[model samples]
Target: MSESNTPEQNSQPASATPPKQESLLANLLINIAIPALILAKLSGDDWLGTKWAIVVALAFPLLYGLRDFLQNGKANFFSGLGVVSILLTGGISLMELDAKYIAMKEAAIPALLGIATVVSLRTRWPLVKTFLYNDKVLDTDKIAAKLEDNNNLGAFELTLKQASWMVAASFFLSSVLNYVLAKVILTSPPGSEAFNAELGKMTALSYPVIVVPSMIVLILAMVFLFRRIGKLTGLKLEDIMAAHHR
Candidate 1:
């Protein structure tokens, strides 16, 4: 007769490792960055103009800096600066009760982000790429090695260019759209009830209009560019993701 196996041993699968926790940076970008941006922009309106809103909006960067500090015992200096800048700007705007200052806050953030992104692209560091993709997997070194071995220098450069352009475009477009909406709201003639109603609708939709389309466009652009880069360099997405994880 054949030997019988125990239930515990027989039921176990060959590979049984648990999933890894998400990296801190990934959590920050997804859960903190986008929502903070939305809150900072929306908090500009007079009706929603509470001091607490400004505090909450500014807390995202602070929390990110705190996480960095806890993880490495050294916070990103610029990240800390960004938190301070947001708080100072919000405080001054609140004290003055100037709606324009609040409106301009949205414009300022995107510009700062664009500048930072451009600076990062100029370096070999690939800071934003590291922040977004690093620690997502466990094979980052292999991916980097593949990128180097594939020798598609042109494709790599194109990826950087596309990313820089997208960052700048998102900033400028969001700022322009927000400015236009603010102008319409501030300039609507008194007693034009129909215009006021339409303005309300536009204002309500403005955040979604700017954010959703920009994000979709950014995603599509990255997908197309990454695919082209993969074909040119003979590197797969899995390879890149793995490389970054290391």
Candidate 2:
């Protein structure tokens, strides 16, 4: 006879063993420092010529992204987007374009993304799920069951649509910020040391400039959503949010 593991033996609590979170230092070093340093120090110099140096600098993020994808067995949506953006930047740099071109380039990505997010709302499976739902973040199945039991599924989905609109608006805000930041910071010609330095500066500032604000918006959206869920399903916040399990 085979024995099945009891909940006591099988369960691992989220609080007991916290998920390992990425560190700020690691994020800075890998995402900003390594690429920025190489570009600033060697990009405009005669070492590999400006063109190839840009390529090498671009390679750092690409290699890192590829390694992550291979290790994870799939490229994450954001990482894949980052790689595409890197390629675009590299191409623009190699073209010997002016700073405004780079500025336009920088803005293009977020603008397109913002547009896409809003457009996706029209589809059956909205892209909000990628940002908000999924097993890693919350147990959608459990929430759905609760909603069904409470006869609040329709109302819950409408609430999600409202939340999704707020999210789209945040992306649009990011797009404007991205454009302005790039336009202001990247004032030197591409392939110049000053240009590379400005690029470095842009990378360094992006967290405070973009990420912090975006996260605040996201948190507000989450709060709004959970509050509605609480009202509709009459579930505690903890009950609606997934339990940490191992």
> What is candidate 1's TM-score against the reference?
0.55
lDDT of 2 by residue, 158-211 (tens): 887888887877777777777888888888877777777678778777778987
The models' CA-based lDDT, in order, is 0.54, 0.74
Could you estimate the TM-score for every candidate?
A: 0.55, 0.85
Question: What residue runs in model 2 are displaced by over 4 Å at the alpha carbon?
Answer: 1-20, 23-25, 44-49
Lowest summed lDDT window (length 10), candidate 1: 12-21
- On TM-score, the candidate that comes out on top is 2
> Number of clashing residue pairs in every model?
6, 0
